[model samples]
Target: MKNRWIALYVENQVGVLAKVSGLFSAKSYNLQTLTVGTTEREDVSRMTISVKADDTTFEQIKKQLNAMVEVIKVIDLTTMPIHMKEILFAKVFNLNNEGKTEAFQIAEVFDQGGNVKIVDIGVDSVLFQCTLTERKNNELITLLKSRFKKIEVTRGGAVAVESISSSCR
Candidate 1:
């Protein structure tokens, strides 16, 4: 099985998200994560989608995606190693000293200093933001240890491009 990070440079238009997601669903492609937003160019949007599929099936998906009229570019951006990261926002219940201590520990471990933002908080819960490598994030989950009641966890898809090598320049 091959895990792919595909980037689409597409024209921004109606139903684009739905159409793209539908295509993935129809083709039975498993999308592990995704991020989409308008690019610097006003008329275009960039989408980063991480999907898991076999090599042959991935090739077919690539061909079909490239054939779409709305797609100006379709890049299978997985092979090249690059800076890949995901941001996760987690909400944990903050009830007592135990809760506060555990939540602080969790946040300290996950937070990349000020880069991660704490968006909101309630009387019983604390929301925290974290940016780190996937491996660190995966390890962070183990620290939860059932002490804090996790309210929610959200993450953005990995965004990366081909790393500049000495030979490339």
Candidate 2:
């Protein structure tokens, strides 16, 4: 199955997040990523969700979400032109001077116009913070894992918005 994306407008109420996530769990639909935050309107929240499913399953998911009372609107974003990014933090330990330099070089190479940077550095560890598309973040993580023996990684779910003029994904 390929990845599908949806944007949900929901009431900003307590337990709304839990109920929305529970629906996915109860249906056994695998949610790849889910990020939610309040919109400019304080009473509403926007959620960007990613799931891997076939076309039919994806349609069902949309229908189910639309039927929920808390869900004000559901927009299918899979084929839409949108800009998306996920936050990633990676720390590599047991690094010497050369290894630390290598880490800096790697961050520079993946900078994408300054979206990646060395956020912290210690005698034996270096932390890299990156904001990039999900695919790019995955590639960075893979490279870091291959190059370092002791590493820790944390990732935030992707957030996306419709492109204003140009097409992007």
Candidate 3:
């Protein structure tokens, strides 16, 4: 199975998010990530969703989503040029000065024209915040888990938009 991306424009009304997400749950589709936000039109909202499925399953998912009343439109983005990013925060605990410095250095290495920064530092803890592609965020999490004994991670679902320039993730 491969990952597929989709963008849904839905009505911005009560129970819309629940109904949309419930469809996935009812169909037993493993939703990898889902992010929703209001658009320029207050009456509409856009949702960016990712799922792992084979071609047939992905097509079925699209059909099912399109049949939903609240879903105004569904755009398959798997092969399209788009830009995407996910928010990740990693907080390392029980750190010493050396460890804190190491965390800062690691963040710098990952920054490379991206948004990765040591947002917070305490006596024994440091927090790294990053806005990057989902895959990159996973790599950063893996690295932090390996280096730090005590760590906390929080991740936001990815948000994506059609690219006007070059394709990006």
Best by lDDT: 2
TM-score-superior candidate, 2 or 3? 2
Question: Can you give the TM-score per candidate against the true fold?
Answer: 0.83, 0.98, 0.96
lDDT per residue for candidate 2 within 31-129, as digits (tens), equals: 999999999999999999999999999999999999999999999989889999999999999999999989999999999998999989998999999
Model 1 residue 156 CA deviation in Å: 3.0
Worst 10-residue lDDT window, candidate 3: 160-169
Tell me how far candidate 2 lies from the true structure as C-alpha RMSD in angstroms.
0.8
Cα lDDT of model 3 overall?
0.93
Q: Local error of candidate 2 at 68, Å?
A: 0.5
RMSD after CA superposition, every candidate: 3.1, 0.8, 1.1
TM-score of 1: 0.83
The candidate with the higher TM-score, 1 or 3, is 3
lDDT of 1 by residue, 83-167 (tens): 6677777777646666866677667656775645556767777777777766676666556546655556777767665567732
Q: What is the lDDT of every predicted structure here?
A: 0.75, 0.94, 0.93
User: Better model by TM-score, 1 or 2?
Assistant: 2
Query: Model 2 lDDT vs. the true structure?
Result: 0.94
